[model samples]
Target: MRAVVVRSFGGPEAVEVVDAEVPEPAARQVRIRVAAAALNPVDAGVRAGVFGGAGKQIGLGWDVAGVVDATGVATAWSPGDEVVALDYGMVKPLGSHAEYVVVDADAVAKAPATADAVHAATLPLNALTAAQALDLLELAPGRSLLVTGAAGGVGGYAVQLAAHRGVEVTGLARQDDAELVRALGARHVTEAAPGSVDAVLDAAVLGEPALAWVRDGGTYVGVIPQAAPAPVRGIRTTAVEVSPDGARLAELAALADEGVLTLRVAETYALDDAAKAHARLAEGGVRGRLVLVP
Candidate 1:
């Protein structure tokens, strides 16, 4: 198998695409012939040494979407069932930047038929983050919810899901993305200005500016765990680190199948150009999730 080998932590240039051995399934694991994977900020950030890589020396993608080619245990799946799954939490996690990946069968689910391989690949990490963030908010109808970085993958999904629940949704993004954010169900959209709200679900890495939008005693959730929140301002803030829940992921897929959600692809690159893929993410302003076709 050909894989992008990361020998050290630094930048995109560290991702070296080279010949590697194909991975096989272990007990309770399924080997996926990877068709696609998504480029997430976490992937690029980890490669850039912005976030701790957890001693990773292999590859750097967290999302995976592919077909099951083999399984260690006899289960409901056959040799060719399209699926989307996250490999980040595996004990000896295999990176998704390869032609084959062996992930625990319990960590994956069938990909929504409504989504093609590239789009299905976008769901695992980002969408799951959105689901977890919203779940933490315990969103209430008629309550105002502000989604920072609303045009990005996690934020975009949060806007729509929160709005679908009839919460008064607001989004923070650039002026260009205001309409796109609005389309995601934000009742109001802005490029980020000083304001207060009932609760702020900040997917945006809005540093000190975060203090402006969250009201006293309001709840706050952050995607970036970098800066500390000013809880002294009477705001309850916590970092929403998403975890892989197969059942919740299955629900997200079902929502996609029912047309309650949509996938956004900023671009798709071939598997071999994994370094270039991470480089593109570094240049910034990724309007949507980036997908890699393996």
Candidate 2:
């Protein structure tokens, strides 16, 4: 099996594709024949040693859409089951970027019926992060919510999901992205939040500035775990450490299939071009996820 990994930390140049032994699933795990995997910012963090696995080969990739080739005992999945999964970890020996990767069976969900592997590959991580962050905000219907970076992957999903729940979503993005943000169901789109909102989902990691957009006694949730701003004015503050929930992912996949959630692929790279994909991601201005097809 060939997998993307970083043996030493630096820049995109540190990303390497190396041949590795095919991993086998342990109890409650399933081995996926990698069809497609989405390259995420976290992969860049890993490559740059942001998570700190010094001198160790740290695998890349987190979102995978593929077929179940093998499963450990007591798992509900079967061989040949098409699925999507979040291979959750900052550092690992192998990841979903490989030709074959093993993940806990409980993290696997059926792929969206309406999307191909490339598009399905974009779903797990960003959508899960957005959905989980919304869950933390716990805003009721008709309440106002602001989604920073609303044109990006996670923020785009946050806009749609929050809007679908009847929350009045305000999308903060680049001026040129206003149309796209509005199309994603944001009640209002802006380069910045105009007034205080009921809550702010800081997908852009604006930190304190975004927190300031939240009204007193409201909520603020950030995607990065433990990176949330300190609470003030009786407002609740927290960060979502996204976890894999097969059941929750299943609902998200269904939402994608039903058109409640839109899946976007900024570009696709051959598995062997993993490094090139990382370089492109580093360039910024990517509207959707960069997918690696094996």
Candidate 3:
């Protein structure tokens, strides 16, 4: 097998493709022959020695779409099952950047029948982040929610999901992304955050700067862990840490199949060109996330 690994944590140059032994599934785990994986800013952070560098050479991938090559005794999946997974609640030496990855059976769900490997790979991490953030708000159908960085991956999903739940959505994005965000179901799109909303989902990592956008006594959901602003005037603030849930992913995949969710891929790179992919992501203005084909 072959995988992209960070030989030494630093810049994109540190990422290298190397031969690796094929991994096997453990009890309650499934081994996937990865077809595609999504690249996130977190991958760059991890590559730059952030998040403790995984303490050694570490593979960089979390969102994957592939075919099941093998499964564990307790796993419900079968060989040849097409799946999309978030590799978050599992222990492993390498991530989905490899040709094969082993993940907990409970962390993967059937991929959208309407999507290919690349599109499906883009769903798990960002979609789960949006879904979990909305879950924290617990907002009722006629309420309003604001999504910062609304054109980005997580924010884009947040707007669509909130709208689908009948919540009025307002998205903060670049002036150029107004139409795109509006198409995703946001009722309003602006470069600046509104004065107040029933709740705010800070997908942009606006952190303390975004607190003013929420109404007093309302909820503020953030993506950046431990970086959300302090609650003020009865406002309740929480940061979301997305967890792998095959059931939730199944629901999301249904939405995608139903055309309620749309995914965009900014670029696709070969496995060996992982460094170039990271460099492009860092350059910014990427319409959506980059994908890696294994």
Candidate 4:
């Protein structure tokens, strides 16, 4: 099997597409014949020496959509079941960028018939993160919510989910990408130069710009780990690290099937072009998720 691996952490060029042994399922785990994998910002962070020795020479990717080829224990999944999953955690390795990847069965959900592998591949990481951030905020319907970097994958989903829950969403993004955010149902789209809002969902990954967004008593959620926003006095600051929940993925799949949510695919690359994908993501301004057809 072929997968991208980093020999040294520095740049996208450090990633190498190498032939490797295909893994088998472990206890309560399953092997997926991956149809596609999506890139997350964390993948770029891990590749650029962001964590120094801890993340060097690692396989970095979390979003995957595929079919079950083998399973260790039967809960609700079996061989050949179409699925999507978040396969990594604080200590777990990322392996979804490969031809076949093993994941804990408890972390995956069946992909809806309404969505193909590409949609499934794009949903796990970003959508899950948005869900958790919203959860942490303890927000409710009719509340005023504001999101920065609202044109990207997670931001797009964040807008829709908040809107679905009946919250009024205001999005901050590029003038060009504002329509994309609005299409996801953001009530207001502003090119406000990344400053000031009611409740802040900071997808820009920058701290200060996001800090300026909220009132003294608002909720602010930052998606990047280690890039914690300052403790704005009188405000609730939440740092969201996405986790794999089989049940939550099922819920997201249901939304997609109902035509209530949409997955935006900005582009697709072959497995070997992982480097270019990384570069594109790092450059910013992409409107949707980028996937690798493996």
Candidate 5:
């Protein structure tokens, strides 16, 4: 199989496509014939040595949409099942930026029927991040929720999901993105600092600064691990690390199929052009995500 590997921890140039042994599923795992993989900022983080050891080389990807090709005996997935998954965690050796990848069956969900593989590949990691962040806040319907980086992948989904739960959403993004944010169900979209929101989902990883957006006893959820702001005035601060949950992914897919959620594909790159894709993402401000057709 062919996989995109980070040859060294430095820059996009460090990423290269190489021939590699096809991985087999372990217990409770299933092998997927990958159709597409989506790029996230975490990929650049991994390339820049945030998650790698000195001189370490590893496959790079998390979001994947593909079809099951095989399954381990303990797995419930069967061959030919179309799926999407968050295919990596803290200990990534191999990942989904490859021709084939193996994932725990419990972490794979049927891909949204309304989307093709490339579009479906954009959902898992981002949507899961949004879902997990919202879970940590435990907001009730009609409560005000503010999402930072609301035009980006995770924050975009946060807006939609929060709205679906009947929570009022105020999206913090550039003025240019107001229309798209509002289309995604944000009741308000602006660059102004939040005022007295019940909760703040800091998808932008703004750290302590975002805490000011939450009301005095409200909640602040951050994406950066251990970077939540200190609690003040009885306010709660939580940081979330997105984890794979097939059941949750299935529900998200259902929303996509029902037209309650929309998938956005900003650009597509061939597997060999992953370096260029990384460069594009690093440039920033691209709406939606970049997909790699493997």
Candidate 6:
């Protein structure tokens, strides 16, 4: 098997594709024959040693869409089951970026019936992060909510999901992204958020500034783990450390099939060109995910 990893993390140049032994599934786990994987910002973080796995080979990639090729005991999945999964780890010996990757069966969900592997690859991480962050917000229908970076991956999903739940979503994004944000179901779109929403989902990591947009006694949820701003004026503050829930992912996949969710692919790179993909991700302004096809 060939996998993407960083032996001595630094920059995109540090990302390397190397030969590796095929990993076997452990109990309650399944091995996926890699079809497609999405390269996320966290992969960049891993490449740059942001998570700090020094003097060791750290595998990259978190989102995977593929077929189950092997399964461990007590798992319902069978070989040839098409699925999507979140390989939830910052540093591991292998990841979904490889030709074959193993993940817990509990983290695997049926792939969206309406999407191909490339599009499905974009769902697990971003959508899960957005959905989980909204869970922390706990806003009811008709409540006002603001989503910063509403045009980005997680923010885009947050806007759509919140809107579907009947929340009045206002998207904060680049001026040029206003149209797209509105198309994603946001009731309003702006380059800046107007203060005093019932809650704010800070997908952009704006921290205190975004927190201020929430009204007193409201909620503020950040996407990054442990990076949320402190609560003030009786407001609640927390960050979502996204976890894999196959059941929840199944619902999201169904939403995509029903047209309540949209999947966007900014570009696709052959697995061998992963380094090039990282370089492109570093350039920024990518509207959707960059997928790697194996």
Clashes of each: 1, 0, 0, 2, 0, 0
Q: Give me the displacement of residue 118 in model 3, in angstroms.
A: 0.7
Task: Report lDDT (CA) for all predictions.
Answer: 0.80, 0.93, 0.90, 0.81, 0.89, 0.92
TM-scores of the candidates are 0.92, 0.98, 0.97, 0.93, 0.97, 0.98
Of 1 and 5, which scores higher on TM-score?
A: 5
**What order do candidates take by lDDT, descending?**
2, 6, 3, 5, 4, 1
lDDT of 4 by residue, 190-294 (tens): 733333455788877767667776777877888876566667757777688888898998899899888767887889999999999998988877777889998
Error of 3 at 113 (Å): 0.5
After superposition of all CA atoms, the RMSD between model 6 and the true structure is 1.0
Lowest-sum lDDT 10-residue window in model 5: 188-197
Tens digits of per-residue lDDT, candidate 1, 160-254, equal 88887888988988899988988888889873445557778888877556767767777788876545476747777777777766778888899
With a 3 Å backbone cut-off (N, CA, C), the pairs that clash in candidate 2 are none
Query: On a 0 to 1 TM-score scale, where does candidate 6 land against the true structure?
Result: 0.98
Q: Which stretches of candidate 5 lie over 4 Å from their true place?
A: 191-195
Alpha-carbon runs more than 4 Å astray in model 4: 54-56, 90-94, 191-198
**Candidate 5 per-residue lDDT over residues 180-213, each given as its tens digit:** 9999999988643544799899988887787777
Write one digit per residue (lDDT tens) for candidate 6, span 1-294: 889999997888998999999998899999999999999999999899888889999888999999999999989999999999999999897888989999999999999999999999999999999999999888899999999999999999999999999999999999899999999999888633445699999999899888778777889999889888888988899999999999999999999999998999999999889999999999999999999998
RMSD, one per candidate, in order:
2.3, 1.0, 1.5, 2.2, 1.3, 1.0
Please give the TM-score that candidate 5 achieves against the real structure.
Answer: 0.97
Which residue runs of candidate 6 sit more than 4 Å off their true CA positions?
Answer: 191-194
Question: What lDDT, from 0 to 1, does candidate 6 have?
Answer: 0.92
Off by over 4 Å in 1: 51-56, 89-93, 191-195, 225-228
Worst 10 residues of 2 by lDDT: 187-196
For model 2, residues 1-294, the per-residue Cα lDDT tens digits are 899999999888888899999998999999999999999999999899888989898999999999999998889999999999999999898888999999999899999999999999999999999999999999899999999999999999999999999999999999899999999999888734434799999999999888777888999999889898888888898999999999999999999999999999999999899999999999999999999998
Q: By lDDT, is 1 or 6 better?
A: 6
